[model samples]
Target: MASRKKNPSKARRYSVKEKEEILRYVDSVNSKQGRGGQTAAVKKYGISALTISTWLRGGGASSFKIGKTSSNGAGGVIAKLAAVHAEIQAKEKELASLRSQFEKLKSSI
Candidate 1:
């Protein structure tokens, strides 16, 4: 028996500006096409539709703190707080959907 070693690949990180550019392009296409624009963005940008969706939903670049400031500064803290709140909301929505699915499955069984 031969043992194979697994190669781990790191996720590519996009700078705030790059993320904004990708999002702007996605928005433009979505506005013109009216639907399935994310699919188009995924194809054009070589990024997953889920990543595009995260950007659209106030995550990604939108969560980044703008300008240089101390961590304890009001602006920095507020921005961080807002980002956390948005993430919490997104997670809550996902949890609700999973719970609904679980309920459906339980009822069927």
Candidate 2:
């Protein structure tokens, strides 16, 4: 076989949910101290620090808002945002159904 550019070991794929979970842990650690969250995450999660850093820069934690160190009401904001997003998705689906129904009624008329 020809030589391959990539390594034989496959790269691990982490879902958005997984990334968020890891990031949350990292956030908690960083908050307790000052920094080194990525390094700490590397030891705990076994994920590459570079990979986590990339995720952080690439908006992997976009699902949850970051920045606030203290627990406080940050969770509340994320919850509200999620609720609103779900509502918008539901509303969009309903609108599409209504549009379909309207078209059917108009054709019948």
Candidate 3:
């Protein structure tokens, strides 16, 4: 067979749900075959062995981390920012109290 160049453009991005479905299929195959047969499923599905392993291990169906890094949640980041802000406010209040005590000692002299 003639060697053909691999095309990166041919790769398709799968959603978390789709990955879960693929993982389910892998698990079904593994259960029927006995032992971890994800290698076979990986070859059959044209997916990487690591991906199959992740699916079999129940690490699939998780979009939370990916979604956090993606453009899906400006709101969540804003909430985090608010929490940081509240913390800074508390620290500023403590600093002000310390400064007030320093001023009181200086004025007594």
Measured against the true structure, the TM-scores of the candidates, in listed sequence, are: 0.51, 0.51, 0.38
Whole-structure CA lDDT of model 2: 0.75
Tens digit of lDDT per residue, candidate 3, span 1-109? 9999887676567665667677666667667977565676667678788766654454433422344343235764565567679999999999999999999999999
**Candidate order by lDDT, highest to lowest?**
2, 1, 3
Off by over 4 Å in 1: 1-4, 59-77, 80-109
Count of steric clashes across candidates, in order: 0, 0, 0
| Evaluation by lDDT, superior candidate among 2 and 3 | 2
Evaluate all candidate structures by whole-model CA lDDT and list the values in order: 0.73, 0.75, 0.64
| Candidate 1 lDDT over residue span 60-91, tens digit each | 34444454532334676687777779999999
How far in Å is the alpha carbon of 15 misplaced in model 3? 1.1
Between candidates 1 and 3, the lDDT winner: 1
TM-score (C-alpha) between model 1 and the true structure: 0.51
lDDT of 2 at 94: 100
